[model samples]
Target: MGFLEVEDLKVHFPIKGGIFNRTVDYIKAVDGVTFSVEQGKTYGLVGESGSGKTTTGRAVIGLNDITSGKVLFEGTDITSKKSKTKNVRKDIQMIFQDPYSSLNPRKRVIDIVAEPLRNYENLSKIEERKRIQELMEMVGLSPESILKYPHEFSGGQRQRIGVARAIALKPKLIIADEPVSALDVSVQAQVLNFMQDIQKELNLTYLFISHDLGIVKHMCDDIAIMYKGRYVEQGTKEDIFNNPQHIYTKRLIAAIPDINPRNRADQFKFRQEVQKEYEHSYDDYFDSEGLAYGLQPISDTHLVALPGKG
Candidate 1:
């Protein structure tokens, strides 16, 4: 019933070995992940490296092929039917991790931003030119910069070009794959604020995948903690922050250091208190098939993964 839903999705890559190269085994990059994104909201995916958060986001956007399961947009499965990919892709756009490499230096900014226009629309010469100028202005770039190449701008400016391109189509769901991870600390907040403004103005949905729990807590209304291609826990922002039920989730929070020793000590004490709470609720989790599915109700907005068996 959500605007976008991913059900039991899996992506596997073959691990080839030996001379003949028979299918030795498969690396489960993403395994049986299920979640939904509602319009005008953000759902964040946070985890360590190799946890398949990127893979899952890629699968939903058709960047990576779906080995199994369904990715539904507006109640229809786009993964099930290849012909629908082009149409489905328009509604969902991705802002890739790197800004420098993502944009082409050879092409001018106008052409780069207009690539999506060419893909989904058959605009006339005058129409394409007009649209590209508007896009440049939308993401805080001057229309004069339209003629400039990627090399003409700094890192933050280049990222603004990427943002312009992503929003050109006015997509409903924007999957930001660590969009700010590459920028300087000062620039990161500016870009983040821009994204927030766009999300509010357009009522756009976002699947923000990042390793930084601090940013996750700042932007996400809800959080899903993934481990080894498994969703170890998921809940609202307040729930995960105030009452984390998973050990991995607690560890991530504790590791976010405050420069002051006193603040750090307080965080350590808080971790100890939460650990005791998790221990008390460990027995309530149950197994589903080969995977353990833990769902503990906390508040109307918060839910925790079943503790233990991680």
Candidate 2:
């Protein structure tokens, strides 16, 4: 079995309206989405804004209530029973998108990182300090800077601090939601490379959720493309990047800025072609309401949402 398996995961929010705030309809944020992550591998969840990437990550980590479905960790169902056990909580952690808002300004770095240790592990003051220091050094931070507040650090430093906190408990899986999107380009590489190093060091599995295809291409082994809360395609990085079947996936891949000046004209032409294809073949890919069809396997490691099945 895979290290983490999400089966038909659905997270729908009630749209309350009218008198007494009665439930009018449901906004299906994550609708019947399913995927799996092997131990010590990174799986990328890529899509545009409001595509349910964040919601899927949140639901897996117990931050949001799952409307229906199962989240299996190591072959055990942790979906409904996450809150009942501290061990489950300790095994799964999250690194949020905005480092500025994720960290509490009022709390010192020591306290912020130690929050998980304090909650789950019965460590003494000295032991906690040592652990936090180890984590700080692991994430390329100074151990002495533990006494500093979140506001005192730069944007990249704050993100490193957040990374330290997430790994403090030695979690097996981390749900990183656009962890480096807030940083500048240089800092973004620094943070992404640092994360890769720690993933190897700790043997951690990452569910990396982001809209930046370039970053995702750098980090992910397997990728899933989402549109309107449903997966349009999922496959190995080679399959998705080298050979994208879905029009939306093709469009996203085409939109990635080509740094080489030699390919400028060719790149522009390719994007135009993909845009024309998307406009003409819109109905072929989507239903009447414009939602992606269910996933159908096209290869051993590739799946795409299309109108008909083989």
Candidate 3:
């Protein structure tokens, strides 16, 4: 069994209406999505805005309520109230998107990193401060910075602080939701590379969620493309990048910006062709309501949403 598994996970929100605010309808944020993360590997959940990628990560970490489905960690079903033990909670943690707002501006860095330790470990004040200092140093920040506040650092540094907080408890799996999207282009690589280094050193598993295919290519072993609360395609990094089957996956891959100016014209032409094909064959992939069909296996490791056999 995989280290982390999500089975037919569905996270729907009630759309209450009228004066009484009774349940009217549901927003199917994550509809029947399923995947698993192997130990010490990165799994990417890629999609556009409002594609429910973030919601999926949140649901897995217990930040968002699961309307239905099971989230199993290390063979234990944590979605059930009785089974989600403290050890399970510590084993699973999340690094939220947007470092600018994720860290509490009011609190000092010592408190931020110590929050997890306080809950999970009974450390004395001296021991806690020493541990926070070590965590700061691990994420490339100075041990002295633990006394500072969140507003005192740059965006990249703030994210490093967030990382320190995430790994403070020595978590086995980290749900990193768009961890670098909010940083500048120049700083994005630094954070990504540092994350890779930390992952290797700590032997950590990651649920890397992002909308940037380029960044996803740099970081993930397996990938799943999400749209409208469902998966359109899923495969190894090579499979999705080199042999995309679904029209949506092809379009997304085609949209990745080619940095080399010499190939710009050719890249533009290819993207235009992909766009044309998507526009013409939209109905062939999605149903009348504009939703992807259930996934069908195209290969051993590749699955694409397609019409079922008659």
Whole-model alpha-carbon lDDT for candidate 1: 0.84
Tens-place lDDT per residue, model 3, 1-310, is 8799999999999999989999999999999999988999999999999899999999998888998999999998888655436689898888878998999999999999999999989999999999988899899899998889999999999999999999999999999999999999988988999999999999999999999999999999999999999999999999999999999999999998899999999999999999999999999999998999999998999999998877
Clashing residue pair totals per candidate (backbone < 3 A): 1, 0, 0
Q: Give the range where candidate 2 is weakest over 10 consecutive residues by summed lDDT.
A: 80-89
Candidate 1 lDDT, 1-75, residue by residue in tens? 989888888999899998999889998888778887788888999998988999989988888888999999888
Q: Which stretches of model 2 miss by more than 4 angstroms?
A: 81-83
lDDT of each: 0.84, 0.94, 0.94
**Runs of candidate 3 exceeding 4 Å displacement:** 82-84
**Residue 214 error for model 2, in Å?**
0.5
In order of appearance, the predictions have TM-scores of: 0.89, 0.97, 0.97
- Scanning candidate 1 in windows of ten residues, the lowest lDDT window is 283-292
| Residue 114 CA displacement from its true place in model 1, Å | 0.8
**Candidate 3 lowest-lDDT run of ten:** 78-87
Q: Which pairs of residues have clashing backbones in candidate 2?
A: none
Deviation of model 3 at 292, angstroms: 0.5
Cand. 3 TM to true fold: 0.97
